[model samples]
Target: MLALIGEALLAYVVIVAVQILINDGLFGLAKVFVQRIRDLPGVDLLIGAVIKREADSFLRQIDSKRSPTVEMSIKIPEKGISHDDLREEMKQLKGEEVNLDDGQIFAYVYTAQNEHYKAMEDAYLAFTDTTGTGTEKGDTDHETLVREFLRAFMHENALNPIVFPALRRFETETAAMAADMLNGDANVVGSLTSGGTESILMAIKTYRDRARSLFPHIKSPEMVAPITIHPAFEKAAHYFDVKIVHVPLDSDFKPNLDKYRQAITSRTILLLASAPQYCHGIVDPIEEIGNIAREKGLPFHVDACFGGFMLPWVEKLGYTVPKFDFRVEAVTSISADIHKYGYGLKGASLILYRNSDIRKYQLFAYSEWPGGLFGSPGMTGSRPGGNIAASWAALRAIGQDGYLRMARRLMEATLALRDGIERIPGLAILGKPEMTAFAIASTDSHLDILALADAMEEKGWRMERQQFPNSLHCTILPHHVTLVDKLLNDLRESAENVRGKKAKGGTAAIYGMVGKIPDKAIVDTFIKQFLSDVYTCKT
Candidate 1:
């Protein structure tokens, strides 16, 4: 009897093992089928084209009233027109009836003040006139000067400390400056990247690599971040093949730390918090999250790309901000953009790590390549020195005092605009934002935020429309200060005009439809096609 019982137990164990194998095989097959469906011919391309058409349609609707009615056509006659004559003809294509006036458009013209525009335009002309041996040579010479200025300003590539000592020095100094601003320690280190997206990518890459090194047994890696965190993190997960665990936000629009704690697991590599995220501009609870990271021994990254430059100065001006930098023991890395609030030219941002040890994972080096030893600290090869120079110049030119004043003006203007929006009967502010960027939504079901945005656009204001709650967004700069009252007046009038109107046949309709789509894969394909179309030029 004992022998029979032992034999039965062994048979049961075998059956259970067989069942596990079958389940694993089925799951793998399902994933493969899904991937195959996504790759089917014409699927992605058709979706992408439709998405582009929708976007183009929206832009056309907005510009319809302002667009020139006359279409210009040229007879080829098997010969091209003279360059000068062609230029003149192109100038004639400008809308004669439409008013091409100043201070009418928003955001596109950053330095719209008459004096600033004049200065910038004069600089452009002066640079254009400077000549060298030939036209191409002259252009090369001009670009060389700009490149040299940038190299000298940034001190060259940050990847090789031995080859470019000055570049390394500048990088070190810049990292120190950034860390100090974010209340980091002397051990804090970081690398500069092209922009906020790249910075976020590097941070994610570092955490992934570090987790792999420390926990080799884990077959999958995951990250926990607030939904409000920049979509760049989602892009990173897609690129790096990591699972993203999104945490919901609280009433204040900050990530709920308790939910984040529950989401943590042995496979989790990183935790991310934003210093006033881009969506609703509310800061997460960094200190509590930092402590959680410390307890879990997980790396925490703070995405301050939007507010990094302004927050430090704002805090100095006596604004209460939560500790969200290296000052917190659990925080390991930070990303900041010099282009946005730093007032630098575009394509400049920095990523800081807690120490050199953690930063090494971000470097890409290949010694066995046929082209000899190749190494890049960040994403791109053949980096632009001009951007670095401009960033350096802007930092020096602005100084602490200049930034402080700019911050004060922007804050005042933003507060006034927020107050004005709040006064609107049906509109509600998304969150308690402490920065110059905020979102406005409709409290009444009948009021459509997109319709309000469209109406505002008709009155010469360009407000961003958002989904997932259907809201209108705005980013306040120094120039917007003077236009705040005018904007509020226009908004009030637009709201009154659109009162009781349903959101139909505008950006509102497109976004509303897109949000309800169940298959995210289809939506992603459409986005890719839209981007491709944007780069295609029409003749």
Candidate 2:
């Protein structure tokens, strides 16, 4: 026993040395090391200690710079705080948040004019049941349907659709509208989800279940997707116990069709393509992949969560967009966010199947529970009806004309931004972005892209930092339409400012190390620790 224990300890030391010595970022040294010693005694503890040391170092650096937070009680208050006092506190707290309204933020919040925001606010509050009103009749006008119908059904629970048929109709109509926009015939059917992640989860779960029923031999079902496919799919795969095989992209940032086709196997249950993938905003060759899926007899899902609400309009505006919806016969399902380009409040997305037969797998039903028979079409029970109503309202109010206008304006801004970036001496846009989202990279090594991002941050611009190749992601929105020229000027100056400097710290240094780290486990551990630390109460 002592000899075996000493052997395990030596193996652990060797594994740690391998991690430190590996120079190639793509080498699988850690994976091999872990595979060999994973079952050894104390190996888990050794790995845990390394993770803790790294996490503690990063957290201390962050903690040292963090501003003092507002005092928060760990326990429930003994007495209710006054509404006015709470509102004042909220206002003060919000004062520290980034001002997205200033058009300096390129990610997270997406907003149009103040009028549209007001409409969403009104629609949301009207359906929140705070006003305490019963059912009331309303006209069929779209805005009226949003305000009056939502007000009438505000007290209704969406979980019991039979009792609240209005919510049922709202959800059905919303799905149908999305289907039609995606070029699905009457055969296409779907359900509303909380957001993109839930939509993706439902799609993945449906396919996994379908595989279980149809191909029981596929005990360990796998999904094949481009590496650039949204992280939501990764989350879904993790949650559903599905292994995902990632295909690398070409120089153009689009998936290599041959590589993608080769990734599929007898165990592969689903093939995923993205309509304008998030990182580089490049749409995969969906038609080609759809054809491949058809030939392979596999289910194909298009994650249009980022572009579904905008691509149709973009195509209508005369830009060449590759076919990516039900129009491609092999596409089994699609997930799109209504809150994004649909101009709705958050918490609304649609997951559509080619037909009801396929969608049935997404539904969950249980009669064994003593709480009575329960059937849910989505992951969540007791979903908010307000989100459904507001989503429908946003789509109805926007119509095709409004969307086309927004699409045109956004595309114009995107092209102008692209042109401006290309004109800059050391900056270049990565990939041919099919939509308003794209990544900016440093063409010259001397100009550190992340350093440029930090300079932009100093100038009050919020940019999303991306890895796998350090770049800055920009998502152009309606609010960004007027800020294009100013943004270009700042970007040009920032690129110049970052010209010969190494990114020593801040987001640059962190993301730089993360991108270069060969063993992704270290990055994963750091990120998990960061997430836990951020949510913790340091007070």
Candidate 3:
């Protein structure tokens, strides 16, 4: 009798434990069992093998001749080469790179005309030294003298406004000009950043700090943004310890308003919208998002990094563009890249705030530093004044008239390209792109866009490939304006060549596997390893 009772008690205990686990949810129990499976012998080895295989596959696609192990001796340069020799070496190196001047590349290089680019180059070369030393060639013309005058403050450090007041004026005046173009009020203010990523990082940092000071009850802060937004925001979230909650896009490739409203929580610190998202180039409903932000009492940020410089002019040219700037009352901040459509040299962007109070959080100051009291308005301590000077020069050189003209031509080319793509039976534009940038996708399953991209690449056309509904990205710059017909012809021929086939090798195969991978973590691991391999020197 005693043995039977003991057995009964043991059964009862097991039953109770099962009931408790069921109440807690079967997901936890499944996870516990799954973890056990992972802990089994050879599971870890299998995972590692899978990751390594994926990585090696990508590396082979990129560099078919790369060795598994590189045993190389380091060579240190003890003496400099002669200037003529250096020039020859540079020419040889440039020969290995794709020629952007031919307008075969879809994106990456944005230039107006040879003269405009030369002016920017001249300006940059002039301000390269502190002693006012310029290029070897002396200025003998009006344009050269103007460039010389612009580069006068090139060596001056923008960190100290008091030491070099001219940089301060250049920055302030540039900010003011941008603000006015965006319909900002007297209270609008901003600072120049290295690029769009830095601008986004500063915005995230500012909002995070602001939340810490004001909303003490919130333990974790979150940013609500559309998934179509740029990856820089993800990087910013990772850097600033802020959580990002992504909202999906609607059928129209715009942010779904209902989902966006539902994603908001008490921890949401900022709301983000893009003037024209990079993937599809469809502008999100910024005005509606601004309303939601206002209703929720959250700060709104418009990422106009790609479209900011072009949209205003596009609107002026009678193109119907949605208001994405300060015209929306809830828009508390904006990030615009002067390097893109603004025709500035690379590595220059602006982070603008609705008012000074909001911007104060972006500033950092240290009084106990050993060197001295230090304060910086932006991220870097020592910034390259040459970029800033060239950006300012670009903005000034390409006044409203110049920008408007480019906008008109770009828009026309974009439409022409879109119509041509649509005319192709198995191809279509991704969405109603409001600007020069857009995407192309295959309508028929048998026609692999990746394979099509590869075919076009073989024909001396470089098209950027995008995943998640596979597509080819195209950005119509001023240089690409005249090559619309050529691009369409190549695209048509490439589509026909790739029809009813799949990418089995090369870069296309890599992208195909990436898009089809169900477990994103595995893809992420492969990407990390691929990047490491790319940057790893043989020596």
Candidate 4:
């Protein structure tokens, strides 16, 4: 046991070493080893070919194929095109895009109806110049309050409260409203962030800073979390030089509380739980986890980014949602995304702490620069007022009653989809989902899930494909209710079509190639190259 723990500690030191080395912004240095592994004789290229087919076929499945002449020769125009021409070019760029309006794709975009998007779009246009002027000429209309926020380039720097009063109010009131939903009183304090990932990053950073302030000599700080916890935490661990200790989930898809509690060491600074984790949508036993955190005197962060806006209504609508909020005394902080279920515009999330003191760590008020006093909250310097104002507008627009109605409709849809998937002969849900998002695995040996996913895609319904358990993921949005009948029909057809038949291509091929790779480090190598390809442009 001591040896295993020693290994974990040694690995953590390496992580911290890399963090120190990369401090001067040698970000690519991080991917150095992963890329080198890919270049090994029996790495991605050779190993992938041995797994299935020729070099070209395996390369295409991995998306490792380089650009051809046409794409490589593409060049920037000397002069900008007209607005109409630009819009046309962008449309052409999509080639044949999936119809998101018709509920053709799941996972990313969350939409209910056309009017919902229309209202947000109109709200966005209302404040086209979201950071135009710091001084506010207030508009009496409520939505113009959104525009009032949008019209000014507002900085919520407490150092210059005189310049932007409305922005600060927007941030405070937005946090207050979210706090109210989470059963918080006046004591709860938080800041608006770019998105769920930023909210998570801020929470991790705050606790790390807090630990540093409290125990100045503690160099090796670690966080305890479930394996199902989002990748954002790993990113946080990498960025903040903190060691994250992850434990596996049990059969019920919750973290083994015994193992979780046992994993806590002297260096442990924080505990983490997720409200309906992104993968299987199974929420951890946060109340239990928080209790342990309190016993240990550690900061407990509940990542409710996916469920924060949605779960309150889910519980209200008579679903068996667990307690994971400010209501739970030991839940010291929570990260929630307003855009996801709050139906706010994209790029808005909130990280809430129990009080101002705890939240202060996330706030950096530095007089380091020559320009008077420059202090900004979170990672971003000049924050977008539009995200803040739009969030406020969205919460107001969809009041409690309105949200309840939306929640009811989505739950019903989710239930229908879940039932349909279960009824299908070969497919089975990974676990009993407490929320709408879930993954469906193939129980029948003959059925290939990735092949079925390909079939679904062919039927114009693109669902998120998942790994480890090897399942097809689905998150039933309100728009999904309208497409359910078609979805079920296509799903059934796909199951029948792929039963006992091997997948020729699509997701099956990709996973097959990936599953063959013995080391995940090699997989990471491919991913790094893939991400590099994503940003690579020619000419």
Which model scores highest in lDDT? 2
In model 2, how many backbone clashes occur? 0
lDDT accuracy of residue 497 in candidate 1: 89
lDDT of 1 by residue, 1-539 (tens): 99999999999866755675587676655655556676898886777688779968976675564444323221111222233442333234222222225334322123454687668655643553222111121234323343334433331333444333334433445566667667776777777678899999998888888888778887899999998889999999999988899999887888788899999998898998898898887778889998899899888899999999888778778877777777788888889997777765457799998887899899888987896677888887645444554444344444566667777888888888899989988988898887888999998777778889989888878889887788877877655768888998998888888988876776767687788899988888988898899999968
lDDT-wise, the better of 1 and 3 is 3
Clashing pairs in 3: none
Point out where model 2 deviates above 4 Å: 1-155
lDDT of each: 0.71, 0.78, 0.77, 0.75
Model 1, global lDDT? 0.71
- Each candidate structure's TM-score, on Cα atoms with residue i matched to residue i, is 0.71, 0.73, 0.73, 0.72
How well does model 4 score by local distance difference test?
0.75
Sort by lDDT, best first.
2, 3, 4, 1
lDDT winner, 2 or 4: 2
How many angstroms is residue 318 displaced in model 2 relative to the true structure, after the best TM-score fit? 0.3
User: After superposition, which runs of candidate 4 have C-alpha atoms over 4 Å from their true positions?
Assistant: 1-161
Q: Taking the tens digit of each residue's C-alpha lDDT, what string does model 4 give over 245-302? A: 9988898878999999999999999999999888898889988998898899888999
